[model samples]
Structure formats: C-alpha cells, structure tokens
Target: MKFSPLETPLRTIMTPGPVEVDPRVLRAMCTPILGQFDPAFTTIMNEVMEMLRQLFRTSNRWAYPVDGTSRAGIEALLCSIIEQGDKVLIPIYGRFGYLLTEICERYGAQVYTIECEWGNVFAPEEVIDEMKRVQPKIVAIVHGETSTGCMQPLEEIGRACREMDILLVVDAVATIGGTEVNADEWHFDGVIGGTQKCISVPSGMALITYNDRIEKVVLSRKKVERGIQTDSDRSILAAGKTIISNYFDLSQLQDYWGPRRLNHHTEATSMVYALREGLRIILEEGLTERFDRHRLHERALIAGIEAMGLSLFGEKKWKLPTVTCVNIPDGVDGESVRHMLLHEFGIEIASSFGPLHGKIWRIGTMGYSCRKENILKVLTSLEAVLVYHGVHVNKGEGVQEALKVYIEQSKAIGAGR
Candidate 1:
C-alpha cells in the first residue's frame, strides 16, 4: 500500500458554483498562518469586511463572513431573527427555497410558502398578494436560484415588504458579484452570500449583513446569554426552552467581528485570505464592469446554445445570466454528455435536480470562468458531444454565433465608453 501527496485535477469549471478560482487567490491561500486574534490577522479581517461591504453595496455595519458554507449564513440569519411560532414565508422558486423553509421550521417558526413553477420567478404583484394574505413576520426569497438558474425579482418585492413592515431576507449566494444586487437600495433587512459563486474563491465562508432595523429586533429580545456584547450592546444570547444551535449564534458572531473580538471558533485562515484577495479582484475590476462582463458572456453563451438548436429551460425574462439552464435534446443522455465533456475536454457542467433532473443541463458563466474563450470552448465541445450522441447539429455554428454576439457587444460597450 502506498500514498502520495494530494494533487487536484485542473478542469475548466462551468458548473453552477465553486467555479474556477483565480491563481492569485489560490496563492494567497498558501501564505503563512497567523493567530486568529493577532493584530495582523485582525487587520486582514477588517479589510475583508470592507471589501465585502463594497461588493455587497451596503453600508450596514454588521457585514462579516460566517465561518462555514453559504448555508451556514442562511441558518444563522433565520435562527437568530425567527422566534418560536413566528410566521415565516418562503416563496419556493427552487430547491434552495425549500431549504430556507426547512431551516426556519427547525427554529419552531411556522413556515408558509408560496410556490412558483420551477423555471419561473414570482411577480412582485404575486408576492404582494401573498404578503397581504400571509402577513408573515419575515419573507425569505432567493435572489438567484442555483437549482433552476432563475433570478427572482427583488427590488419590487423589497419595496412591498418595506411598506408592509415585514423584514426581507434574501439568499444571494449565486448572484452577489455575478449580478447587480443593491442591499441598501433594495431595503433588504438581511442578505447572505458566499465566496465560491461569483467571488471566484474556494468555498468555506459565508458573508451576511443586516440593517439597523433587524439589529433593533435582536436588541429588543429579552433573552440573554453569557457572551461578549456586539457594537449595538446587544447580548449574544438566546432565550426560550430549546437552544437554537450554538455554533450558528449570530449575536456571538456579531460580537466576534465587532469591537469585542471575542473568540467564537478558530476562523478558516486560508479561506479568509482567499476571500480577501477574491474581493480585491472584484474591487479592482469594478463591480459594475464585472457584472456587465457576466451579462455579455451569458448572452453570448445563450446565443451560441440556441443557435445549436437547443431551447433554454426557463422563461427568457427570468433566466439567470451567471447560470443558464438548457433543455437536453430528446434521446440524449444528459449525464453522459456531461461526463464526456469532463473526461474528453476537461470541461465541467451540471445536471438539474429533482423533477428537472435528466431533462436539462446547467451551464454556468461565472467568475473567472466567464470569458469569450471559455464560452467558445464550451459551445464547441458541447456540439461535439451532442453530435456523438446522435443529436445532429452544426459543428462550428455555435461558436460562430457566439463570436457574432461578442462582436455586437464589443461595439455596444465601445460606444458607451
């Protein structure tokens, strides 16, 4: 028996998330470690928070990274704000929506859901109607549904929630840097994001932020626990019979990131480095330009795919630019095509989930992977794979159509400049 030092394969990641990380960020993660509370390390933490605020386009003082995956951030936000028997409404647009509902239910909150078809987003009017009927204390929705590659409309919904005096919690795990999301302007009460999606970093941390209104709710709660206080002097404690999971306590997390600097757990130091550098890249490129690049690449990919004779899965208006869902042609094994792309071409794409599984393939134009070259390569490889599966299509037409889209977009961007 023998073992070798671990090595990871290099593949062009076109999957929905955890996209190909930049080499610079990978190098940043390899730097020497430091004590979590060391001055240098704390300085790095401060920089990370500032970068995240810039990326999130929010002025909220509570912005910081949670010590686990994106779902951890979602749980922390929900478990903290949702008291026992509080009414929580989740609009189920995809699998992640159901996940939000489940997390709220675990906190003993009464979970109610308004469902939309898999490939569609809810209209603001529809959500307003639901809010009137449900009158929920909190309304949770996904800004970009990774499962179905659909972007839910948030601005109008946020305005409606504000008028109704209901808190809005958004899961922007897939949209944050890849699209336009203005937390403060949208009147979002709390928003959660992740590093792996648009930030182009390895996964381990989740960024969460809350406005002052939500802070007031946390302060008003009578529950108190023994922990360091946060900036608002709110105790990091939960009352009631059952203790919500201790590891995910937001109050304590807020304290640790705030002035107190209390120890919660050892932070993921390497991931922090990666996240900071990833965010630096975003700021360097300018968030709006990054977003426009994503849109341009997305349009090119869709134009190429459609030119290849495949129809997209979602409504055109609601399709997510970062992750596009395309219907698999009849008689084609979606999994086999994906396997062929990986093994034969070193490209990766994803299969849909649940009911959409085996019916569609998810192709992502995200982070460092979203580029003209990558778009052409994916379309060319996909054409080969599809033809091999007996789905006859023009071999070079997709790339040509994609090139045409790039030319038009280049002209448009030039004119704007």
Candidate 2:
C-alpha cells in the first residue's frame, strides 16, 4: 500500500483557538532546521525571549516558550511553585479557570475557588474579598475566558495580591498579543500565553514570563539532573526541594535557556522559528496597533451579528474582543448552521462547551483571521445560512452594518491624514 502526500482543506477558521496562522509564520516554519544548541539557533532563542518580554509588556528576566500547547506552560509554572498541600485560590468564570484548578490539584495543591456565572466575570472587589477570606499562597485566574467570551479585569486583583503577598499567576492565552497585558504594571508574578489564538502562530508553543517574586519560589525547588550536572551543579543538586516532573521543571529548563546551557530535552526548532517570526510580525505592527486592529475587527463582527437579529451572549463590558459569543437563534439548530458554514462556505466557527454548547456559537476574529475580509465573509455567510435555516433575519443588514464600521474607520483615518 502506498500513502499519498498529506493534504488538508483550505479553511477560514473562525474559532476560539487555532485560528489561521500567518503566512509569514508558516514560511518561517519552513526554514532549514538548526542544532538546538548551535550559536545561531541559541541567538534565535534569546531573540524569542526578548520578543516575548515585549509581547507580555514585562521587564521579567525569564521569558520563554515551552515546547507544548498553552496548557503546558500553565502546568510548568504551577508544578514548579506549588508544593504538596500548598494552598491555591482559583477563580472560575469559565472552563479554562477550572483547568487551572485541575492542574493545581494534580500537583497536590489544596485548591480553593470563587466562581461567578458563566457569562459574567467577578468584580475586582469580589475576588479581593475572596483572597482575604481564603488567604491562599497563590491566586490563579484567567485573563480571558474564551469558553464564554468573558475577559476578567485583572488590575485590581493584581494589586490586591501584591498587598496580600500572594503570588498572582495569570493565564492570558487568549488575550496576550491581541490585547493589553501589562505584566509588570498589573503586578502579575507570572503569565502564560499561547501561540495559536492571537499570536497568528501554530499551536505548539506556550509563552511564559515571570518576575523575581515567582523566580524565588522556583529556585527554592530547583534540582539539577545528574546526567548533565557539573561540579558546581553537583554541590547545589537537591539542595532545595525537587519539582515533581523533570520534563516540566522550570528550574532545570532555566539552566538550558540560561547561560549555563545545561542540556534539557531538545528544543522544537520549527516552532521556535514560527514563534520568532510571529513575534516579529507583532512588533513590526506594534502592540498598540495590533490591539487596535483586533478591537476594530471585533467591533465590525459584533455590529454585523447584531444587525442580523442575533444577540450577543456575554456582558458587553466584559466580552472578549477576540472571541465573540452569539446566541443561537430560537428554533435553529446551531450545529447545523455551523455545518453549513463549514461545508458550504469553507468557514469554520466554534460551538460553546457544557451548558453553552448548543445555546451559543463562538465566532473568533483573532490573529491573522481577524481582518476586514474574514469578518465580512463570516457575517455574510452566517446570514445566508441562518436564512436557509428559516430564521427571520434582516436581509443584507449584517453585511451592511459591518461595512459601515469599516467605512467609518476609513473616514476617520482620512480625516486624521
């Protein structure tokens, strides 16, 4: 039997994650492979760290991408600092928040939680109040809950955590590159980001940054692997408590990324290239500009959806700009519409999870997929599909409203010029 060369359909992905990777990033991934520790490749690694620092808006000494999806970075950070029976506070507003709780529990943390309704985020006062009550060693929260398209405000929580001297860990996977994540000003001890969502890169890397406050805890749990231990390392080996997973150990991974250059697992070369290029694209456009772009597209998408007689699912103020949640119209099969969008239009949008699964459709205007062309495509296609399903929508109104947004922006730019 002979296997053919791999091929996949061309799709316009309008999902919460794994959105379209930028063409530039895809080209970068095709660059010839280099030895992971070669001077040239290491230079690229250092560049990636610096770029990650800029992307996260942090002055952190440690900024790098882990070799797995977004969850890997979250797990590494939690496992490194959380010892058995360490008290942890997780505020769950969506599915990813529960993911943090699960990771913490697996690492033997005694987890405490505060939860709000799925479509709403907790007030800063509520979270701060919980922190005072629970007084956990760490507070983990999601900056953007893509599952419900709610973005929790973090500044107040961060300030409160600092005042209480509890480490504040944030999962900013969905909001990092697409929105403002001031890691330092927000007082986050650590932040984990993903490549696939707003970074316009493939889904193989998880970016992380941590200030010295978290570093102190990670260093306290450091243990050097015996195989690669130098004489100096041998002296300090096992001096502190050892982290549970060797592969996910932040302490050991640091040495490999640090000047000591101790060998850990081989790095994922192509993904690093993709990440570097992705970061460069973001920096080239500028962070503020990129954020504005995401917001602009999101506004257009929302305008179109609302004009077509659809209702948005989450609170307007707390809604995530990258992922928009639209209510599934009454008497329409949400999944069938999605199927029509995919099979008939070659467009892919996501459905919600758990209670929201059939009640809402998640449309993502994220990363490279967040643009005028794709937003219009989704709006027009969705309107057509809804009409086919016998839903009464304002014919042509969806595209019309979306075009108004774009036209207004263009006029504003012209006036500025």
Candidate 3:
C-alpha cells in the first residue's frame, strides 16, 4: 500500500472521545523539548500532578497521567492492584463496564459481574446489594458508559464501599472534566480519565489518581517485583508476584512522576504539554461553570433532536452530558445518515456498541467541540441527512427548538447572576 503525505479530514469531531483539540493546547505541545529528568521538565510534571488533583477533586498525592490512552490507566490500576485469585466485583451496565470485568479477569481476579440493561444505569442501592452479597475485594465500575450514553451515580455506592471497607475503582474517562468527578468526595480509591474527551487534548494520555488504600495494595505487589529484580528473599516473593505488565507498573510509573524521578520510561513530553495546557484551561474556566456549559449544550441538542421527530435512547436522568444516543427512525438506515453527515456536511457522529449498532446514533458534545454553534450545525446537518434518506423531518424546526432552549437557559443564567 502506498500512502501520501498526512492530510486528515476537516470534519467536526462529535464522537465520544478524542474530541476537537484546542489550538492553544496544540501550540503548547510545540514547546521545545526538555530532558525527562531536567529540572524544568520535572517542574512541569509536578505542576501537572497538582492540577490533576484539582480536576479529580482529590487531595491524593498519587495523581498523575499514564503514558497512553484512557485504557492504559484502567489496565495499570487493575494489573497493579488485582493479585492472583483476588475477588473483584464489576457492575456491567455497558461496553466499558464489561471491559473492567475483562481486565480484572485477565489479572487473575475472580470476577463477579452484575448486569444492568444497556441504555440504563444501576441504582446505587442495587450495586451495594450485589457488593454485600459477593463481598469482593474491589468494586470496579464505569462512571460514564459512552456506548450507552449513561452516567452512573457513584456517591451512594461510594459510601457503601467505605462502609464495607471495599475498594472503589472508577473509569471516568468519559465523564471526568465534562461532568462532576469529585474522586475524594465520592470515596473512589482509584479513578482514571482520558485527556481527549472533555479535556480536549490529543488522545495519548490517561489521568489517574489513587488513595492510600489503593497505594498500599499496589505497593505490596511491587515489592514482589523488587524481590525478583534484586534477588532478595524469595520467601517474601511467595506472598506476591511481579506486576503483570512492565510498561504499566504503577509503582515504577509513580516513582517516575514522584520525587525520586525514577526513569521508568521515556515520558510523552508533547502529550504532557498538551495535558498541562488542557488542565490549565479547565481550571481557568472553573469546574462547576464548565459542567453547566456542558449541561446547557446537551439540553439544546436533545431539544433539536426532539423537534426533528426523533427520540433519545437512554433515560434523561441517567444520560451523560458529554454523549447522547438518538434512536434511528423507522426505515431509515443509521449508517447511511452518519455517512451523509460526514461526507456531505463534513460532520462526524458515532454509532453504538454491539446490539445498539445500526439502531442508534451516538452524538457527542464534549471538550472543545461542545459549543452552541456546533450543536446547531450538527442538528441542522442531521435533519438534512434524515430528509435525504426519505425520512420526513421539519427542516428548520431543529435549530429553532434548540435556540429556544438556549434562550431560556441564557435568561435563567442572567437572572441567577
């Protein structure tokens, strides 16, 4: 195969992840490279960790970014924490929840997964009940299930975990900066996120944090790794095994970001620059205000879809602010509509996972792309695509309805101020 010089499409990204990158972040990533252990680079690393603590709403000292996508953080947390034969309880609500189950099982954890229907989320009580019954060492869950556009409520479940003395791990890759993710307040032992979603950076880094409880568990396993490397006492190594992954070993990675400044691997310097700029942008905007912004746009997008005579897939109360799922109209091909939206209007939206594929459309209002004009553009373009497929839709109603919601919300904000 022959390929030409790199030139990507200009389509507006409206997918669940790797949303539009802010130009400011792009420029920050272009800064001159510094050696990984250089004082200036170490300072930036420290700053990034501190900012991550703010974003995660945690005072935990272990907050830092993994060197890969959001999944890297997930695997790092799991592979490091789940020792052989450890019992882990996973509540499977969507594709990502099943992912946790898969990862935990791979790490030799006996996985017990309680299922909830797709397009819906579990009540905290239900999860707590399962946890009580199963009595697992760790309760791993997805904070936001992107495939189904549902955000799981974790506060009550968190308290339940604290009461039972069980570890609470959350995959907040889809919800972190776009919604509320107070890791400490929610009592999450381990929390993971991606910079590409609401944070609006390029998709290469995973923001991760863990509390002391989790640190203890991970460090115990790392001690075994140390024994193997240093050929110390083999007896202490019997109680623990080396962490399954060399690249994702949390102890070494943490040391690399920690005061020791251990050289675990070559840090992704450019992505670090991007993540720091993105975190700075989030801090400057204020987390609460950013959440309101996401909420406002999500409302407008729903209004537009409704005005076009389409219904949403998931329950509104459980719906994610960053992503929304629209049911495909009867007799209209979902992929055809997505194809038209992309090729004809230079717009991109996503399709759902497994059973929902071809039956629903997943549109995202996340990161830098979560703006008023983009919402209007997507709705208007979507309406055109629906009509092209012989689905009769009110042409102008979409944007008009969206504008009405925007106007009402703007007035409400002004009144409050």
Ranking by TM-score: 3, 2, 1
* TM-score for each predicted model, relative to the true structure: 0.95, 0.96, 0.96
Q: Each prediction's Cα lDDT score? A: 0.89, 0.92, 0.91
lDDT of 3 by residue, 312-358 (tens): 99899999999999999998888888889999999999988888988
lDDT ranking, best first: 2, 3, 1
> How many pairs of residues collide in model 1?
0
Residues 1-417 of candidate 1: C-alpha lDDT, one tens digit per residue = 899999988798999987999999999989999999999999999998888888889999989999889999999888878877889989998999999999998888989899989999998899889899999999999999989999998999999999999999999999999999899999899999978888899888899999888887665552444433663334223334233777887777877888799898889899989998999999999999999999999999998998998899989899888999999989888999999999999999999889899999999889998988899999999999998899978668889999999999879889999
Please report how far candidate 2 places residue 330 from its true position, in Å: 1.2
Deviation (Å) of 150 in candidate 3: 0.8
Better of 1 and 2 by lDDT: 2
lDDT of 1: 0.89
Question: Residue 198: error of model 2 in Å?
Answer: 0.4
Question: Which runs in model 1 stand beyond 4 Å of their true positions?
Answer: 227-243, 412-417
lDDT of 2 by residue, 173-285 (tens): 99999999999999999999999999989998899999999989887656344443577665544443346788889888888898888999999999999999999999999
RMSD of each: 3.3, 3.0, 1.8
Best by lDDT: 2
Better of 1 and 3 by TM-score: 3
In terms of lDDT, model 2 sits at: 0.92
